[model samples]
Target chain A: MRFLLLVIGILYITPVLALSPPTGRVLLTLTGSITETNAGHTAKLDRKMLNALPRYSITTKNPWVHQAHKYSGFSAVDLLKLTGGKGDLLRITALNKYVIEIPITDFTKRGAIFAMRKDSHPMSVRELGPILVMYPFDDDPKLKNETYYWRSIWQISTIEVLTSPSKE
Target chain B: MVKWFRKWLPTSKLQHWYVYGLLSLIVTITLLASSILLYSYNGNQATKQRIYEDSLWNALQFQLQSYRFLNYLVQIDKKDLPLNGAAYTQYDLLMSRVDLLRSGEVGYLIRGLTGGRTVRLLNIITGELELISLNLSKIEEGDLSYLQDMTTRLKQLDNQVNEFTILVSKGTNLYIARQRRALGENLENVRILMMCFLASLFVLCCCIAKGFSVFKINQRNNKQLLIDIQNIHEEKAKILTLVAQEARPQIQALLGVPCDNTESSNSIKESANELLHTINMFTDLALIDIKKLSLDITTESLQKNLDDYVQIFSSKLQRKGVTLVSYIDPALPDVIGLDFKRLKEIILELLLNAIKHTPEGSISINVRPSSLTPTQQPLNLENRRIGILQIAIKDTGFGLEHAIQDTLRASPTTQDNQPLILQNNIGLGLSLCYRLVHLMRGEIHFSSEATSGTEFWVDIPYEVSQSSPENISLYSCPDPKRALIFTTDNHLANALRLQLSSFNIEANRYLEGPYYDDEDLDLVIIMDSNLISPEIESNIKQWQKNGTFVLYDHQLTKDVQNKAYAAKAQSLSFPLTQSRLNGLIMDAFKTD
Candidate 1:
């Protein structure tokens, strides 16, 4: 039993992940320059699959929201880890076809998150959900700017990591 | 402005307004620095907002979402496919775009871009989009017609959104252009302000640097000037020494070996002697002024020196057709320790000064005690006498100008290089005399009565003298007798009485207020005839009857003299000498 507990502890401390294939409807796709694959060099994530990972909440205000709301989501850094994504730049696409390219540092350095729920309730498609790329604006004054605002694309459908044109 | 300020400011302003200028410069620099900081702060805030560009992007995204949704609806109708999750996603994405444009900061930007028309247009579009969204599930199974109608409506909505986006793009472009122009103007202002501030700072620094150099140069020049002045002073001393050491002795030796014994030869000798003396005095003056003159104080005959000066001046007076008379106090010491050369110079110069201006009238030099009468002075009849010896040179010349008189009357303030110029002819002589007298801690006083005469009396302290005339005359009189002086209490009478007392003729004095009425008075001398009242005249006549011989001053009138003869009183000259007074007394008591 002690040996089993130590193994679990080692698994928790290390960034070793064995993400299983999704059984629910896929809500997000990760392709290009990813190590882990559920469907041939791609990661198709379902809501339950993302939910199985650790959850996070960011209480922050934005232009789209009237007041600060506790947005429950998966951390962008943890999600990238689950997909085993690698690249300097992240190319994101929203359901509305509004696209933005951001540096990976926004996830690793600025603590960006993909919100699926607001105030403990799952958001509908019309409510800018499934995934909303958000920054904890109240945490860092630097992130509360137009550049970061434009980078926070909502209803995100896809994230493509571009290592290089030749690699793709 | 500077001229106006200068006109208003006091005359004694600093040579350069560096301090105030530096203060104003500091204030200006502070103001300019703060202005730049404030400008940068505002620019930072505008950069932070970046709201206009964000608003434009949001509007474009809203319009694009509308077209994309419309396109999807059209594709569904063309393909005759059942509307499913894909169809719902497109509708939801369009709804979210509309929501984003209709609410919050992006919504306000669209409203402003469309002149507030975005609100109504968005409301109608939102109603239509919501209607389609509500019936989207049903449309997925049965009717292509309803989907086609919704597609046309969404196309119309996309057109409206495109119009709003165009307006936003135009407004954002205009705002950005205006901001760029304003930024250019602000940058230009900052540039000009920076240039002005730097130029002023440069000028102030240059002025300070130049001021420092000028101050250093002036300091060097002043030091050089001091050295030059010292050189000039040394040169003057060398020249003075050359004249004193070489020229004066040559003149003296040339005089000693006479050429002819003629009047011209004698005159030349006299002139040579005068030149030697004048040169010596100037050398002495320099020494005395610098407080370097040392006296050869010695015990010498003060009376003999005085008599010698009197005799020499008397002969000079005779030749010049002027009289010189001297009256030495009979009670002064015969020997005293004093600087004889300086004393001789003082007397000779004073006499010469008087003779030069006198023209005709006599010059009288009187020597006496500066303080109490000879009898009242502290005398043990054996030891040395200590007193202030007053030597008064009274000339009957046309008196001095009141200005010169007042100056001489005031005691010497200091024994300095520049002696008091008592008069033009008096010149260095009397001035030198003033210095000499002060060197011995002496005082000089004078009085002038316009055309009457002037008297300069020098009173020197520390007179160390051996025998007084009063002591000498005590033996000169041979007998000590009693005499009554019926005289006014005047200085002249007091002096004469004191003289008589020195002659051992116990003299009693009387003024007009009271009479020394002694019935057995052998002899009576009346100094002032005006004091001879009727009762005094009767007593005088009685004294005559009792064989009491009497005398009166020669200055009395004929009427008083006749009365004096009736009262057996004789008339005699005033200022009687010691020998003359003794002779008169012996004659008066010959029968005894």
Candidate 2:
């Protein structure tokens, strides 16, 4: 009976461990001071891997939108937990070479998200999609100014954690 | 200018003007306060509107930026560049900003500015965003053909958003300008209200000052008037004192004379007494003029007083050959509230006028109870009996001329014309008579015909006195006496002889030039003498020594009466009464 109980426990724990290894092409990369990784010293995530980290949906207006649209993603804090990323500042880079520096505290405080889908659909490259860094601008009045809006990077490619303060 | 102002200015009417001004001030203040409150409320609403408009403008700016970014993404995709996830994210962001602008405070402000134009723009933008979003999936799959169509639609929306933003900005500026102008007008109204309040205060001060000045002037005038009245009173008192002091001696001498029954002697005495009474009435002229002569009303015989007054003119009437007729109503009260002295003067004045004017016709006086003249009756006597005693004096003489009659009826204040009326010798006595009648609350009427006569009727109000008349009979001498009389005047000597004969006393008259001794004389009578010579005085003494009684008529000065009394003779005044003569005869006979 102890053997049967051990098998059931293994069945429940297997799927969770299986979700940590990315099978599709890597869309997001996390580097520096990381404990968990899908490959080597850095943590790299595909769409399916990022989705497996606690999903949430939000509707908000931003500087780039004509109407409020629904964005489905995992919170930045959840993604950091999945990669075991530890840092005071995050340097994010988009595919178009657009870069922004954000405090790591903003991830938890402002409900910052790594958006994978807009209006319930997966984002394409031409749509500034695949991954986007978004803050809930409409929900929080303090995040509505230019500082937070500029920090919300679109078409994000990589996140580098740094313990040092940014020059800007 | 001063006279015109005096005529037109509301001098004593300031209170009414002040009340009206105060009421208007209160109403104006209330109106101004209410206007200020309403203006402040309007200003608050304007501020709220401006805040809403500013929020709407910020929303439009955001929507424009989102649309521009979407267009940039589409351009990048058409250039065969890797957009990554930019196109879909930009499209979603543009849609979200457009959705926010369509509702909430921004929506409300846009709707207020262009009615439904903003909503229509929003609908068009929304429809364009939905179409672009649908094609977003196709473009992501490496399909670059839809990029041009999406860019064209986004460019159109950008143009429309820019136009709507300008419209909203212009509309907001105009609204702000209108609000500013309204606030300025409200301030101007407040300034006008302040000026009006100051003006009202100025007018109220002027009215109060004017009223105070008028009150001061009235007080000064009243003080001056009081001083003038006091001076007039002092002057009147002095004149009355002079008249009373000068006329007292003559009046006392005349009152001492005894009255006799003989017509000629009685008329002489009556005329003298009337002259004294006239002077006494003249002394009281000031009192009568001021209406201060109160009646000393008492029970007295009006008929008897009238008879005495009538007798004063009898000798003149006799000499003028005018017949005298008199009548008295027996039913009239024997005693009534008559100021006897004033009434006697009134009768005497009328009688003298009649005697002076008549040539040969008869003069008559009639007394009776009669109705008061229409003007003389008091208004409040509806339930009470008002007794009026009418004394009418009718004379057949050259009637009073029209002008003289007018002067008689004229008010006494017209003293300048009084002397003119008296120039005819008729109005002086009648004027005096008229004043006396009026003083007694009486009315006098005169009727005349040019060639015939004039008549005066005086009606006086009286209260009947509750007293009976006294009856007194004349006394006669018990024995006839042989008496000697001495006088300087023939009329007086003859009057004395006639009066002696009525008492059956045989008397012989001696003129002033003679002296005689009679052994059979029982009494000696001296009529009147200012001074007696030593010879006449000795003769009076010799008659006293011969057991004869002497009686002297003292009509001269007080010194002459002292001399007569020093001679040890009984002296009597002129015009002796029957009772006095009877008493004298009884004393003389008792000595015998």
Best by TM-score: 1
TM-score of 1: 0.47
What proportion of the real contacts between chains A and B does each prediction keep?
0.77, 0.00
| Interface RMSD for each predicted structure | 1.4, 8.3
Q: List residue ranges in candidate 2 displaced over 4 A.
A: A1-168, B1-227, B250-275, B289-292, B373-386, B401-404, B407-432, B469-592
For residues B126-174, write the lDDT of model 2, one tens digit per residue.
6766776887787777787877787777777777677666666776777
lDDT of 1 by residue, A1-168 (tens): 999999998877654234577898889998877778787567889999888778878899997766788888887667777877777678999876668987777777888878898899988788888888888999999886778988988888898987645445
- Model 2 DockQ vs. reference: 0.02
True contacts kept of 1: 0.77
Model 2: lDDT equals 0.66
Residue pairs clashing in model 1 are B331-B470
lDDT of 1 at B528: 65
